[model samples]
Target: MVVVAQQTPSGPSPLSVDELVSALELRTSWTLMRVALRSEKLPIGLGWKDLKANASETHSIAMKLRSFLRDYFEESVVTGERYVQIYEIDKALVATIVNACKAVVIPASPFSSKYPLPLNVNLLATAPSDPTLCDVRNHQNGDISFIFCSAGYYDDKNSYEYGQLPTHVQQTYVGIDKLVTVRKNYYQSYDVITLRTALDRLEISVDQPGRLGSLRFEARPMEILSACALHFQSLQGFGACPPENLFPAIAEMYGDHAAGKVVALAFRTMTGSVKRERMTTNDDDLRDERFHHAGMIAVGQDIKPYEIELDMEFTAPGGIAGVKLAGMMSQLASANPTLHGCYIKAHQFIAMEKALNRLMTFI
Candidate 1:
C-alpha cells in the first residue's frame, strides 16, 4: 500500500490508505512489473486529478513513490539471501521494475571438429633473484623464430660488352638462412695488470739478441769528392745543392793551390735490441727516472741497426747530400789527417788530393 501526502497553506494533509491503495495497481509481465500513475480526472477509478492540480500533492506523491521503491527492493526474502530488483520511472510517476537475478550463464561450447587443434603450453622457471638469470628467462619467452630464402637465375650473350652474365645459373644461394637453436653463456673477465703481464710474457718469449757496433770508412779526398757527387745526383730531386764557393776543395782544383792536402772520414752505425717487461713495482709515476729508464731499455731492445740508418746527407746545412759532403771535406782540411791512421793510407793522399781537385771542377 502506498501513502501520499500534500502540504496545504496552513498545515499538512495526506492521502488516506484507501485512496492510495485504489490509485496504484500492480500489473505483472514475464520479466517485470509496472505501475502507472495517472490524473484523477481520467476514467481510471483512481482520482489523482485533484492531486495533480495541487503542485504540492504531486511532489508529495513523487517522494512517497521513491521511498516505497527503495524499501521494496532492499527487503530480504530468505534467511540469508535478499532479492534485488532494478527499476526505471518517468518524471510523471509511471514506473517499471525488473527482477535482477544472480546466475552464471555459460555460452555454447567452442570445441568442435571444424575448430583448430590446441597448441601445447610449456612453462619454464628461472631464478628471479639473479638479474642475469631473469634476463635469460625473458629472452627465452620473447624469442621469435622464422625462415627466409631466395633463389634466381639469368643468362645473356656478349656478357663482357654489356657487363652481364653469359651463362650464370645461380640456384639456392642461401645468404643468411640460419636458426639459433641453442643459447650460449658468455662470461668476460679482465684486469689491467693481468692483461699487461700477459703481453709482457709474450714479448719476452719472442725476444732476440741485441746488437751494438760502428762502421768507419776512409778514402782519398778525390774519391770522397767523387762519391759525394754521385750521392748528390741521387738526391737532386730533393733540394738544391750548395754553391762551389762553400767547399774548400774548389781552391785546390787550380794549379795555383798547394798539394798533399788529404782528408780522413768515418761513419759509425749502432744497433740496439728492445724488449717489453712488466713493471715490478706498484708505482706508475712517470716522473721517476728509474721507472722511465726501465721502459726506455725495453724500447731500446727493439731497435735494429738497418732500421736506424742515419743519412748524413739530409742532416747537412742545406739539407742536400752535396752540401754535407762539402762540409766533411772542409773539416778534413782543418783537422789532423793522421789522427785516423788506421783508415788513411800514405799512398792514397796525393791521388786523393788530385781527385778532390777534379771533382771540385765537376761540381
Candidate 2:
C-alpha cells in the first residue's frame, strides 16, 4: 500500500505562496487585450448585434477554457501530494489562499447598462402590418424575468438616460458577462492561475503583517454568494462539501498529514446596537449582523458575532444528498448570537446547503 504524506513541526517544509505568485506573475500578461480575452469581454459593442456577438464569443471561449482548466486543477490537486515530498501547503495555508482568492474579484460583465426599447414594439411588429397599428406589448417583460413576451424592448429610465440599451437588457448583459467571467475564471486554467496567485499572496500576507488587508475577498450578498459557491464547484476538478462544515473540513483536508497547521483566520469583529429603544427600528438588526459576518467570512475574517442564524446543508462529493453536514452552525452560532438568531425556512436551508456544498466542491 502507498503511504500518505505527513507534516513536521517545522511547517511542512514551507511552501512559498510568494514564490508561486512570482512565478505566475512573471508569466502572466494582465494587459487589456489578455485580460479582456481571458475575461471573455473583448470586442465591446453598442448595438444589439454587437452585444449578441459578445455574448456568443463569451460562451465559446468559456466552454473551451473551462474544459482545459478542469483537467489542470485535477492534476494540481492530485499532484498536490507530490508537492509534499519537497514542501506541503498546509491546510491552514490552503485556507488562507482560498480566502485571499475570495478577495479581489471584479465583475466581468459588459451588459449591466440599461436598454431602451418599447415592450409593445414586438406586438406591433407581429400585428397585421397596419401603418396606424401600435404594438401593445408589455414593455416590462424583460424587466421581470418570468414576464416573457414576443421579441421586444422595455422603455425605462435606465436605458433612456444612458442613451443605450434598456435597463433590463443592460442589467442582463452585465449579468451575463459577469457570469461568463465566473464561468471561465472558476472553471478555466487562466482563472485557476489567478486563484492560485491570490492564494499565494494570501499566505504571504498572512506571514507578513504589513500586507494583511491587501488581498481581501469582497463579500457577495447572500443570494449571490450562494450562487457563486455553486458556480465555483462546477469547474472540472472541484469537489463538493457540506455547507456548515465546508470551511473547517476543507481546512483539515488541506492541512498537513504529520502535524497540524495553523490557519491564519482574520475578519473584523462586530459590535451591534443593543439598546432597548433601538429595537423598534424596522431595519433587521439581527439580519444585518449576520450579513456583516458573512461578509467577513468572504474576506477570510475570523469573527464572532453577538447573534447569528446559520442555514446550511451537506452532500456527497458528487452533489448527491448524503449525511447532512452538522455541528459547525451551532458551534459558530454559540460563538455569535447573530448566527443563532437568523430565521431560515426549512426548504431554503436545504437548498442553500446544497448550493454551498456544491460551491465548496468547486473551490
- Which predicted model would earn the best lDDT? 2
TM-score of each: 0.10, 0.17
Q: How displaced is residue 178 in candidate 2, in Å?
A: 35
Top TM-score model: 2
Q: lDDT values of the candidates?
A: 0.20, 0.24
**Residue 322 displacement in candidate 2 (angstroms):** 26
Backbone atom clashes (below 3 Å) for every candidate: 9, 41
Off by over 4 Å in 2: 1-41, 53-244, 247-302, 305-331, 335-363
The lDDT, on a scale of 0 to 1, for candidate 1 is 0.20
Tens-place lDDT digits, model 1, residues 253-321: 211222221121121112422322222432332223365446546565232110000111111111111
